[model samples]
Target: MRATIAPQDPADNSDWDVDGSPPDVVIKLSCPNAQPAPPSEEVESFTPAWTQGACDVLSTDLLSAPIQFSVIDVDALFDDPIVSVQYQVTRADIDRGVMEFTGSGALRSVAFQLTTYYAE
Candidate 1:
């Protein structure tokens, strides 16, 4: 699978150092039934992690098992949770071409664009 991630944090930049210093987001995935997905991505504020490829869903119960996306800030000294969201991927959505979704956490929201197949 391929996906894009974007930060929808509060627009107030007064407290943030806007000279290209924003929280670097680390994207991680987990499923109830297998080893975690590989090639976790990192994205900057408002910047999308574009079209990440080749995610294999190994669970037998693909519909019932949830796929979780965890967003973390890598710039922090310690582990910081920015957002955690989960959705069950169904075969119908996969065959429909592309999927778009959004999720909100305590600090901000995120927008995602997903595609299973790679194309020019």
Candidate 2:
């Protein structure tokens, strides 16, 4: 499955240059009763950015699982998460091709694509 994530305009962009430094972007995903996918790729020191990432999940029944996405900032030595959201996916949503969601408060909006087949 693939998820394209980024900060949603003003809320996420407003603090782009926090303390005169760019925010390091990180995305994470998890599913209940299944091994979590490796954290998504990170773009170091970015401001108001978007990222496309994919993970290979081995679960046989993804429809029953709720996938969670978390967006965070990687600081000098710690990770500060901006938003975290979870959705219980169905086969229909995956077939639909595109789905959108948002994080709490200042977390950015996220768009994701689901597919059972992968193209090399």
Candidate 3:
């Protein structure tokens, strides 16, 4: 799995200076193989028990800031047990100077860990 970073606005170059100092950044995670398994009996009985896995962040270049993340989209592939997950990170989180990007895994048995970086 790979995480890609891109400016939200293509025409807005003010965020970056001549020295390559980016005022803000956004990080997105695109997992091609992520899916939720069948719920257990306990889950079925309770309030929709969703599988929880660990997404270990291996690395990041983002400065210490309060980063925000949200699930943007999910796509299920054909003839495969894997699904795709898209996560979005906003610039407001960067303004707070937060570092770590932590979240729970999607599937019941599957876990994910990703490394990311903040551009200069």
Model 1 ranges with Cα > 4 A deviation: 1-20, 50-54, 58-60, 104-120
What tens digits encode model 2's per-residue C-alpha lDDT throughout 20-76? 555566777775555566766666543333344534443345565777877776766
Q: Which has the higher lDDT value, candidate number 1 or candidate number 2?
A: 2
TM-score of 1: 0.59
Error of 1 at 100 (Å): 2.5
lDDT of each: 0.52, 0.57, 0.27
**Local error of candidate 3 at 46, Å?**
7.1
TM-score for each prediction? Answer: 0.59, 0.63, 0.20
Q: Sorted by lDDT, highest first, which candidate order results?
A: 2, 1, 3
Instruction: Superpose all Cα atoms of candidate 1 onto the true structure and report the RMSD in Å to 1 decimal.
Output: 5.8
TM-score of 3: 0.20
Worst 10 residues of 2 by lDDT: 1-10
- Global local distance difference test of model 3: 0.27
Task: Give a tens-digit lDDT track for model 1, residues 32-119.
Answer: 5655666456656544454452245432444567778776656545644566778877776566634445444334444334334322
lDDT-better candidate, 1 vs 3: 1
